[model samples]
Target chain A: MPEITYREAIRHALAEELERDENVVVIGEEVAEYDGAYKVTEGLWKRFGDKRIVDTPISEAAFIGMGVGASMLGLRPVMELMFWSFATVAWDQIINNAGFVRYMSGGLINCPIVIRGPANGGTGVGATHSHTPENMLANIPGLKVVCPATAYDAKGLLKTAIRDNDPVMFLESTLLYGNLGEVPTEEYLIPLGVADVKREGTDITLIAHGGAVLTALKAAELLAAEHDISAEVVDLRSIRPLDEETILKSVRKTHRAVLIEENKPFCGVGAQISSMLMQKAFDDLDAPVLRISAIDAPAIYSPHLEAKQLPRPTDVIAKVLSIC
Target chain B: MPLLMDTAVTTPNFDTAPINQSLTSEDKLRFLRDMMRIRRFEQGALQQYSQGKIGGFLHVYIGQESVAVGTVSLMGANDHVITAYRDHGHALAVGMNMNECMAELLGKATGCSKGKGGSMHFFAPDKNYWGGHGIVGGQTPLGLGLAYGIKYKGLTGAALCFMGDGATNQGAWYESLNLASLWDLPVVYIIENNQYSMGTSLDRSSAFRSCLAERAAGFAIDWDTCNGEDIYEVRAKTQIAIDRAHKQSRPTVLEIDTYRYYGHSVADAKHKVYRSEEEIERYKQNHDPIRLWKARLISEGVLAEGKYDEMDAAAKAEADESIKFAEASPWPSEASISEDVYFEVDRQTIAGRTGKHFFND
Candidate 1:
């Protein structure tokens, strides 16, 4: 095993897939020559040349729509939005064209396209730039939404996303890009819609994904060291085809659950998880399921305000303590 | 200070460009026959819509046949075609089977889009016809991307993107045109300026009422316009655009001044209030593309008077036969409810074992 950064893992997945499939090309603003805005696609241009790694103009609607069209033809296009919030400018192409093309064409067309970029808010990019919109994308019927918390999951899941024959929304984290985690030297793939139990316990399940997964893990460690309470950390890698069985199985054993996310509290991923648990594992719960999410406000630019806006480890710990 | 509206409207010079001299008698007949077929088929669709046989939006291409017939006829085998919702005429012009198109309108399995896409959305990938996009300017970028793919694959072909007069006002349209020019992608964006955008006329919707083609000058792209009532003028103008796209990988902005005889869609009543009966009757009688082309064919001795009448009858009969085929086709089965939501082969194995929320087995 080798410790690698999440950004490196994503680059590895993109480079390897681009090498494996001639049809797979990367298209985005600042993806090539500039080596990506966040440098997630660093050095790909030198290795793959200009055609495979395309640098597009600042036209989200045009490039995203082009991705849908190119995917419809034959090529597999990996479109990158500099930030997830920019997707609002291209909503028609994402939802109407990419999401409905296959269904509308009666399976005759498949958008083998991946719209990937950082979607989490932590670096003080403000309301417009900072958005954890996995919940919004997952709500679409024909799309697959994936948010990987670790370097290993990023490499494995992005590879699977490129190979999959449907539109995939690959949500990355601004905070997690620099974080390091252990990754195996051998090739591996983590299937979409499968939940990963990062740490096991019996007292309560602190469920999270993406940036909040790290928060839950830190909370679990604190809960064990300080309070001597065992907390299970469940990382929901993929949110759309949610692994309900894994979630319910963990809740059944723990008898208590606390869902955490960086998204706003209203109609967030936590809302869906709570409703599902209330319906499926009502009798198994020892207490009502609690949610630890960002405060119901736009992501402010002030560092202190941003800290308060997003879910912190202390918030997750408090939720777990309240539920347990 | 001079006002912008005071500028004289310089009518485009496509009518003066010499007609394609290589056209044979059969090509001339085809130009006439194709326009006639679309006009008759749309008339049939309008009658069906009135009788409650067709559902969803039925956008008839009654008056703007020359635009589709002219542009699509010049496309090569490898060239791609895409258009907005007023697409029945575009599909037929590209040689899509009439029965499947009719079946699609009737919501039957035998439809070109397998009954999934109604009147606003139709796709035939094998025929190089990308779709019949519903959203006004939704197809612009997609069409540009198709051209991008053609260049990416090293194909010596271009893509023709058809859109309504209203679609030019959308942000996507501007974004697509800018990129097409910046990248030198082989694409021709045709604005089928059919007078009205739903019920709002071009003058009301656009700031530049005199010429939509001049908007291309902002992007440094080549611009052209044609009188879409005459097939020869449309053919000559579109041929220049297509040649530039295919040979030089240059983008062109072509705005054809066409009109829709019927309302925007079959169910629309605003045309009655927004426009006058006299104006509609005038377009039908004087500037009808089919009638003008038929009269030209007879006068030029390419077709006789009796033979022209026979061709008109045959076009109507052909349209009627398609309706019969659509009436006989079966509705899609319930088992296929969620079949195409995702490509089943690439789906994760775990997805198959679970009870999905929005999709079926």
Candidate 2:
């Protein structure tokens, strides 16, 4: 086994997929000679050459739309947006073209593309740069949304996303890119729509995804250490497929649940999860499903204010304790 | 002043370019027949819209038939095409079956898009016709991407992106052009300057004083303009652009100054608020591509007298048969509502199981 950071996992996935599949190509701003803005695609440009690792201009709409069109023909294009907030410029291409091409073409065309980038508010990047859009992107019928919480999951899920025969929104976060986790030395794959129980306990269920999974794990540890309470942390790797069985099974054992995320509270991922728990396992709950998310406002630029804005382990602990 | 004038009245002679030397009588006849078929099919589409059989927006490509027919004729089978919503003519020109196109317009299951996409979104991947994009200027980058794929795959083909005059003003259009030029992607950005973007004319919409093709100069892409109403001119200019693209992996911006005889859509009738009926009549009588081509063919002895009447009758019959097929086609079933959403898995199954649990039941 080898321990790797989330950034290296992404690089490993891209390098592996590019080597394995002749049709796979990566296109984005700063992906080539610059080694990606976040360094997630470091050294790929030199290894794969210009054709496989394309360097695009600062035109998000053109490159994203090009990715969609390229995927339709034969090439599997992995388009990286510098920040997920920039996806707004190419909304029509993502929502109308990539999301509906196969359906509109009556299954005649499939847009096998992956649009990935950091999408969170951890770095105090302000409202324009930080946008956790897994909820919104997952709402699209034709799109599959994936957000990984660990290095092992990042490598596995990204590989699966590239191999998928449909458009996928691979949401990454700058906060988690440097975090290390143990992964197998040999090739491995973690299927999408599978939830992982980071820490299992019987008192309460802490539901989260992506970076929030760490917050939940820390909160669960605190609950066990400080209060003599046991808490189970569930990491939802895929937002669209939404492994309902694992979520229900966890909540059923714990009897109390608290949804956590770094996105805006209104219509966020937590809102959907709460609604699902209410409809699916209402009687099994000892208390109403609670939610802990970022404050319902645009992310502020000040580091202190931004820290207060996003959900933390303290917030998760408070929500869990209130429910329990 | 020319700025405020209806340029369709003073239609330039697009036949000035030396025609393809190898062009034969069969090629001329094929163009005539295809152009006539587009005309007849659109006329039938208008009829269906009026009769409440066809719904949503209907943009009839009645006057600009030569642009699509001529440009498509020059493209190889491997070449890709993408166009705006006024696209029935282009779809037919690119060899999409008339019945499937008509069925798509009628919202029937047998349509090229299986009724999921109506008039605004028709796609036939088999022919490399990417779509009937409804959003103005949305297909520009997609077309650019198709060219990128061609270059990436090392294919000896180009992607032709067709847009209306208004779409030239879109951010995506300019972005795509800049990237296409910078990358030397094999792409031809065709601007069908039909004089108007909906009710607004080019003078009112475009800030540029020069031709639309000059927009390509800003990106260092090669640029030219042609008489869109003339098939020979459009073919000659586009063939050169297409050839330069495949050989040099360069992009070209081509402006086809054509006209629309009718309103922008069924809702915007001709001469209602946009212009006068007399103005339209002037263009139709003088600048009709089909009429001009027929005359040239007849004078050149490629087409005999009375042959046009036979072609017209045949085109009308073919269009009527397509309409009948569309009328008899089935509607997409209820089970298909969530189908085709994802190629890797079933979207409907996920949707159906959203709140489904043993405890809930």
Candidate 3:
């Protein structure tokens, strides 16, 4: 076992997969010569050479559609987006071509491509550059969306995503890229649609995905230390093939749950979870399934205001306190 | 035969360009038959659409037959073909049977896409036919990717990507051109400049100098234009681009000037609003690819009088049989609604067995 940053974990996954499969190629802007926009793909390009680790012009739709076409021909492309916000320009390629090609082609072909990038809102990058589109990606029937919150999960999930025989939307948080955690030297895979119970408690349940999992954990810790309450923290690693089994299990024990995410309050990931819990575990819940998201507005440029716009531990704790 | 008769001796000064000098008389006759087959199949599809048997966008490639027939005639073992929505021409030219293509348009389970992809997305990877993409310029990048994969695998072939004149205006087209030229990908962008994009004429829609393919100059890509009515000229001009792709791993732009008899799609009824009766009559009398090829073959003694009538009759009979097959084919099962979304789930792999994949009531 070794402790590495979340960015390194992603890079490790890329290296391992690229070594294991000759068909795997990492393509994106600044991925090869510039190391990577976020440095997650650093050094792999030098090792794999230009063919395996390719760079592209800033035409998102063109290159991304090319990746879809390449994937159909059996080359597994791991396309990196500098920011998840930039993905909107290529939504037709991502959602229409990659997402629907399998179903539309009647399974005659498979688009085995992974589109990975940081999706977040806390960094004051403004509205256009800080979109958290996990819900948008997950809402589509054909795509699988992943948002890993730690180095261990990032390494495991990315490896699985590369191997999955469908289009997978691997959403990362730029804010969490350097966060460090222990990852095993041996290869392991965290299957998509499986939730991880980070902390066990009895009083209430706090559910979140991606970087919001850290906030949920922080809130859980504070609940125990200050409010004399124990809260369960559940991390929904994958959004689409949702692990309702784990979520309901945690909620059944705690009898209360609060969904939190950095995505906006309007029809976000939390909205889906809330609907799922209400439909399936309505009897077990002590109160209505509550959700706290980043304030329902454009990402403000002011750093202080942007920080306030993101979901925080205090907000999660306050939501839990009101219900419990 | 076209409903409007050739009452005027308005045929242009169409000359003979050798039809792939390597091709024998049998091969030249086969080209005529293939083009006639496309004409009949499109007629069947149009008839079906009028009867309300097919739904959503039926873009019949009636007049522009020689471009697909000629360019696809150049495909080698590793070469591929992909086109936009007006794709029945390319699909037939690539050797896909009338049965599966008709069944697909009919939305039946026995179709090529099993009724999942209607008219716009037919695929036959086994035959090296990548797809029948629907978007204007969407398939250009996909063509580049197909070429990229061929180059990556060290295979020798070109990907012939066909698009309409309208696709030339897309920003993605320029982006794809830039990438293909910068990377030296083996792709030939064949523009079927059918004189109009939907109802708007090419000159009105495209603001390019001389021709649409001329825009390739910005990317330092080689380009040329050919009169698409002559199959000989079509094959000869197309071969240059395909060779550039296969030998040099470089991209080229080829604009084939052709015409379409119908509107943009069967759904588009305003095709008559923009172009006049005489203009349409002129194309039908003078520039129709099938008519020109038929005339060229007749003069060359490759086709005798009444022989093309026999071939056209045979193609119509085959199209009729395909329509019967489509009408008799079963609709997809309700349980199949969730199938084919994931290859792993269909195969039931260990990884795919981990979670609930498809959801239904």
Best by TM-score: 3
Model 2 C-alpha lDDT versus the unseen true structure:
0.87
Q: DockQ score for model 1, please?
A: 0.58
**Model 2: colliding residue pairs:** none
Q: Give one digit per residue, the lDDT tens place, for model 3 in B323-350.
A: 9999999998987888898777789887
What lDDT score goes with residue A215 in model 1?
Answer: 90
Q: Model 3 - which docking category?
A: medium
Q: Which numbered prediction scores highest in DockQ against the true structure?
A: 3
**Best to worst by DockQ, what's the order?**
3, 1, 2
TM-score of 2: 0.96
Per residue, candidate 2 scores C-alpha lDDT tens digits across B1-361 of 2522245445455455556667888999999999999999999999999999888888889999999999999888669999989999889999987899999999998998889888878888888899889889999989988998898888899999999999998999888988898999999999988888899877788877578888789889999887777787888899889988989999999998888888888877643577767767877997888998999899889998788999999999999999999999999888677667676555434333442211122
**Native contacts kept, each candidate:** 0.60, 0.63, 0.64
TM per model?
A: 0.95, 0.96, 0.97
Cα RMSDs, all models: 3.0, 2.7, 3.0
User: Where does candidate 1 stray beyond 4 Å?
Assistant: B1-19, B345-361
Q: What is the per-candidate TM-score for chain B? A: 0.92, 0.92, 0.94
Badly placed stretches (over 4 Å) of model 3 are: B1-19, B359-361
